[model samples]
Target: MVRKKLYRSKKKLGQAPGSVVYTGERPKEKLFLEAFDFTKDTYTEKQLTNIEDCFEYKHTETVTWINLNGLNHVNAIETLGKHFDIHHLALEDIVNISHRPKLDDHDSYLFLVLKMLYYNNSHNLVSEQVSFILGKNYVFSFQEAEGDVFNPIRDRIKNAKGRIRSMASDYLLYTLIDAIVDHYFNVIEVLGDKIEDLETDVFTNKSSDNLSIRIQDLKREILRVRRAVFPLREVISKIVKNETNLIQNQTSTYFKDIYDHLTQITENIELHREIIGGLMSMYLTSISNKMNEVMKVLTIMASIFIPLTFIAGVYGMNFKYMPELEFKYGYFAIWGLMVIVFLVLLFYFKRKKWL
Candidate 1:
């Protein structure tokens, strides 16, 4: 009986009011808030529960970063939108999980979308959409969940070790984007390791169900990485060119750094694709070689049996040979002659290296 094949779909459900929309099944509601207020010499971080509390420090001339872990709270989003004068479409795109990685510039703010990746416990790659709205003084980030890969950047900002916290919102946006792009490198590293393991298996072992599944999985991951990373280069390119004053000249340099990173990532993806193609070829060649070996063995067995079958048929003829019937040891002589013929053929085949 043929078995039904199962596949995972990439489609996601439509966004609903006060819902956490993702590119997969419905996710649970999880909202976390982390606020960072920093200047040249002092910094403060606080985990906030109410969005109104964030307004207290909004106009303090400090670069305030408000990170919202989930976008399911429509009221909070609306409140922030009214407070910061965010464009309606930018707010809508924040709740819409299906938005591609892009940059949309409004007169007062810049809307940036990106995909964040992490290796899950099952060693499979997972992704989430993160959207950024850069205003005059505050930078708001909306993500699918808390505890993103931005912890390192947060640490750096907290320690006052970098020029990031002292810079404008554009630089902060660059740091956030740079962190996300760097995580792509991490994801690619995992994929690279998987490709290496697949290469080893393809060369040393016959193609099995598991091996084929692995190759396909790796291909899917590479495609996913491509989708997440390829457009980011354009995003950075636009930023570096200073298409919008949202990114200042000094901040454009940081965007250039991100552009270089994206270039390296794109190159890595292409190289991994070549590696996957090579593994596929190796798999096909292995199968072909095995089939050829089987055909050779079958051909040799048929060749050896053909002559024996003919000799037996001749000896079993209904009309016996008169001279052979008169001899008492005729049967023994026939068997010995057949043995000699078989030995000769075996020797020939061995000499020709066809056995």
Candidate 2:
């Protein structure tokens, strides 16, 4: 899958720097743009289906968030770039799904790219690239599709919950990043539960069939999560220490908090990777021990049968001049000798602890 995405990104190799070729799969859901404009005392949120109406709030003094969901609409995004004076490369990154998570600071706006991860209806992990363009009084958030993990933050802005309404656009940026960071904890918790279940199954169940495939899937998910999260250390570090006026001094502390959370998340990811390594070793050892036990049983059975086969072979070589053939007691004596030999070998094996 990663190779496939890289192939898609290569389509724009020789083109202009800001070309708008979407290197992602065509979206299933339609495009949508929701506008949220609010002051300290007043609040308004509206879903704007018509992309052209987004221009109205650009001149508003209130803090406005123009969330443009579904990046498949290249013309609407181009329209936004024209209205807001957004750089063409920024627009290109917004449409390109394979863009790595990064922070690009402009003269008038700060652009941030991040991955939003969530489990879809089928319980499979799915992620979308979310791009944010933060201006002085207005902020633009672009997503690949209509849904989001930002519903709680939306509710807070609507009810004027906490200091979100009273803060500047940079503050809104902090809250948005904070919301994203908080969601990581939820993701790791879900992963912890899954790891616990896999551990239990591997240790207790005799049939650990398909365990390797499941573990590989989990490690891939962890790698994806790490890729989604680990780079933020540098990205947020840049934001916190940045000299740009786009991030205020007071809000730097909030970003610092997010950086701390990212640090903790990275440690958890490392621990999970270690656990996966241990499970792999345990699985191989278990198989080896099981094989050893089967080999030991077969070895003991072979030891007991070898001498009996030798005695039978000797008695079956009959000759007319054989002295024992004339005696009636010969058959009984041979049977007794065979029984004695078997018992002696069994005792020796028992004494040697080979059985």
Model 1 per-residue lDDT tens digits across residues 32-78: 78899888788899999888877776677878888997677767887
User: Pairing residues by index, what is the TM-score of model 1?
Assistant: 0.87
| Candidate 2 Cα misplacement greater than 4 A, ranges | 316-350
Clashing residue pairs in candidate 1 (N, C-alpha, C atoms within 3 angstroms): none
lDDT of 2 at 154: 95
Q: Quick one: best TM-score, which candidate?
A: 2
Residues 161-182 of candidate 2 have per-residue lDDT tens digits of 9999999999888888888888
TM-score of candidate 2 relative to the true fold: 0.91
Compared with the true structure, the alpha-carbon lDDT of candidate 2 equals 0.85
The superposed Cα distance between candidate 2 and the true structure at residue 157, in angstroms, equals: 0.9
Report residue 12 deviation for candidate 1 (angstroms). 8.8
